[model samples]
Target: MKNNTPSTAHLKGTRTETAHDGNAKVWLNGKQLNLQASLKYCSKSPTGFNWGYGGSGPAQLAHEVCRQLYGLETANLVFQDFKWRFLVTIEGDTFDLTLELEEFNVGHVMPLIETAEDTDLCETQNGPTGHGETCYFDADQGL
Candidate 1:
């Protein structure tokens, strides 16, 4: 399938770093961010739709880091399927922020997929309802 994700180069500047002390520290325009916090923010599903996965976790974390670093309203991520390469952009300059999973202890916070009924409700003409709700086969139940 074709990837439709947009670029983040229009934000501000790029922040790059490698994993250090079990966390990745990112610097952008002299501001600093601890990626451990980013992991926590991204690991949780905002919509509670799908439990965060390794694939989406990094993307979400990167997007958030970009926002904090550059004060950008939006950020985007593009992933290379093989070996899990992620190309993220914020606003100004595009650069790579390398994060090694092992170095950052990513496995500890990584989300798992499981089968379960979705207790979340949806909006309807009358109100919120679960009449047509379906079970989530790959959801994170722990979170």
Candidate 2:
């Protein structure tokens, strides 16, 4: 049978487990950023998986993802289980990003599978948001 978790299968690399606390911090170039950021896995939702602060969409979400995933040469992030904090500078634009994990929602983390009917969610400059409706693994449960 196919697995039911998105965190355990999609991210194929070294990862560490963290405790859920609803708060954490991410940094870049020795600078601190957002503190109330949330991240949740949504491997089973229609809108596909999304990571953002509060209910903000695409642009903000893209920045949040890139912040944590981006770095000068490498990006080090501390997954405080229930929260994420990071600093993001899109190419040259700078911004502080925070993500909050809500109830470990699986549907919010899955990437949006491209459908013939639905066009990809486009950002002004960030290309595809990668919120595709299918995540081979769960972001909450490590592999």
Scored by TM-score, the top model is 1
1-143 per-residue lDDT for model 2 (tens digits) = 11232231111111122212322233433344333341232211222112333222222333333334432111111122222332122221223423332233233322222121233222122213655222122344532
Q: Candidate 2 at 24: error in angstroms?
A: 12
In order, candidate lDDTs are: 0.29, 0.26
| Number of backbone clashes in candidate 1 | 5
TM-scores, one per candidate: 0.27, 0.21
Error of 1 at 16 (Å): 13
Residue 138 lDDT in candidate 2: 33
Residues 1-143, model 1: lDDT tens digits: 11222232221223333221223333533455444444443332122111113434344444454335222212211121211333222222233343333322222111110111333322121222532111222233531
Candidate 1 RMSD computed on C-alpha atoms after optimal superposition onto the true structure: 14.3
Deviating ranges (above 4 Å) for candidate 1: 1-23, 44-61, 69-143
lDDT of the structure predicted as candidate 1: 0.29
